[model samples]
Target: MDYIIKNEKLKLIYEPGKGAWTYHLRIPNSEHIEGKWGEIKVSGSIDDYKLESRNLALTKEGDKILSINNEIRTAINKKGGEGSNFNAYSQCSINCNFSLSVAIL
Candidate 1:
């Protein structure tokens, strides 16, 4: 699993659990607005993410028809910490399909 950002490779570590998979992503040399930056830690479960299905709507007017676009619901999170105190940087939904494609990155 290769996670790439701006052509730079990212390091991802995976810890398998009985019900879920935990991921630790390490972004090297993350920069801040003030130029002071450090390592960024993100952790989450495989089930905590999801890809929603899109819906379409149509309307008819005599002999005409219309269509509506649907949006995808995505849940992305960035977490940090060491051991039991691991904290999530953002709100993450605990329901998603797990993929190991990005685990080896």
Candidate 2:
């Protein structure tokens, strides 16, 4: 999924998993904050979910912030099957540990 900043015309790419979701945010060129890309993990029951991620790191052009070595385990509930009222907790990490929770929906 892609999200538009609406105010800055920025496009964000998001990857979704079972009871979790990750995203790669594109930074604007104007802000000195520098552009960054990271992932997030969300877990919990279908009705409720918990999310967490690493911090964002500064990156330059063609620079990779998140890497396979930076992945981290997130706390979640164990339940939910393929298609049932069940709730299962799962674990997932991004390329790097530099990430933060954007939102939960």
Listed in order, each prediction's TM-score against the native is 0.22, 0.23
RMSD of each: 19.8, 12.2
Sliding window of 10 residues with minimal summed lDDT for model 2 = 79-88
lDDT of each: 0.24, 0.27
Collision pairs in model 1:
12-105, 42-79, 47-96, 49-96
* Model 2 per-residue lDDT tens digits across residues 7-105: 232223344551222433333331332334433332323224322333333444633222111122122222211111112122224422122222211
- Candidate 2 residues lying further than 4 Å off, grouped into runs, are 1-6, 14-22, 34-54, 62-105
The TM-score obtained by model 1 is 0.22
At residue 40, candidate 2 shows an lDDT of: 32
For model 1, state the Cα shift of residue 100 in Å.
Answer: 20
| Residue 38 lDDT (model 2) | 39
